[model samples]
Target: MQPDQVSIATQGLLKGRRVLVTGGARGLGLEFARHAGRAGAAVVIADILANELHAAAEDLRAEGIQAQSVVFDQSSPESITDCVVQAAQWLGGLDGLVNNAAITNSGGKALNELDIDVWDKVMAVNVRGTWLMSRACWPALKASGRGSIVNLASDTSLWGAQNLLAYVASKGAVIAMSRSMAREMGVDNITVNAVAPGLTLVEATEYVPKHRHELYEGQRAIQRQQVPDDVSGVVTFLLSDLSRFVTGQVMAVNGGFVMH
Candidate 1:
């Protein structure tokens, strides 16, 4: 959905907030940034894809959102640290963080069949990257005094989806980490939570098998295709003041695919 089409209910929800979204060049990450911007937040979108990242920021700017882009590689701890420093500098301290950058190199491969290097890469980016980025942004988030962190997890982890062991395990770790991080950061007024989305239709998910999509559609309570819009609103709420009392929780925005 376009930034101009943001729902009236969420307008001004994040007024005066500053947020940084990882992997904001495209897909769900881009949608999260758009929603945050529409809610009146100053946003910095970080990604490894420099060209697409800049283009997305320009698009957000055209819609009158305060938006900027930074390039960073999630697999590198140095890059993650630098990205947070640059983002926080641009935003004058961050009120919210969306850890949405992750890789699924082990997709379609069983644990036994997955290459060690691919599995390592997935864990490095999805698990370690999330940890490092959150740590790097901790001080800035805490300084905001009403900080919020939303880690983008996957429903696959909850249900134990096969053939994607590395990705599933990585996201599972994120959910667990969010809980512990919440407890530690709570004293500082920083809310940490995880959002688990199931099989959304986006550019990154185009490689998902048709059978898997059908399975999700058949099993979901909503009985329809999942879209980025469906999940982005929940992330925005977590970032906004409305959820100040909500933290250390895992919300599954999967149309009842997994109610737990």
Candidate 2:
């Protein structure tokens, strides 16, 4: 489906919820923001891509969704804190946080050949960034009295995909961290969950080899390329009041690629 035609079945499911999505300039992040906004939540999309971020928020506004944009660098701690402040201020408070910013700089490189700097960068953004963003958003989310954190993981980590050690390891950390965070934050009525998507067809995965893409497609039960919407709905559900009792869980939305 075209971008404008992407329909969210649960309209007003997130009514009165304020959401902040990281790396929301394009691809899956953008789609998650769109779905949340369509579900009746005001959204703030933060990204390092200034131009695309603003343009995306404008597009959402044009569609009559309450949306805003903030520019932030996921690798920088100060930036992550500032982004949360800006987003929370804009939305009055944060009800949901989507930790979607991540890097695959170590992609296509074997563990032995991967540069230390590349591995560190991936960890800094994918692992540390998620932690800090969630930390910074904690107060606002807790104040909302019903907060949900959705951390973006990858199925590559579950199946131990080769030649992508840094990213895989980082997402695995995210999965573990989400569970820990959930256990600690459940007292505050906050839910922390991880969503692991497969080899999705998004801008971020454009560099994935054709053979790898075919491998994902041929091995999946759905037998087709996965789109952003396939995962966005679950994310929206998690962010909404519907999942108030759910916490500390990992939902793999990979078309049955990793059935666990």
Candidate 2: list runs displaced more than 4 Å: 1-6
Candidate 2 lDDT over residue span 51-74, tens digit each: 999999999899889999999999
- Candidate 1, residues 1-260, lDDT tens digits: the string is 45444446699999999999999999999999999998999999999999999999999999889999999999999999999999998999999999999988788887889999998999999999999999999999989999999999999999999999999999999999999999999999999999999999998999998999999999999999999989989999999899999999999999999997
Residue 5's lDDT within candidate 2 is: 39
Error of 1 at 36 (Å): 0.4
Inter-residue clash pairs, candidate 2: none
TM-score of each: 0.98, 0.97
Model 2 residue 151 lDDT? 98
How far off is residue 131 in model 2, in Å? 0.4
On a 0 to 100 scale, what is the lDDT of residue 104 in model 2? Answer: 90
* Residue 94 CA displacement from its true place in model 1, Å: 0.6
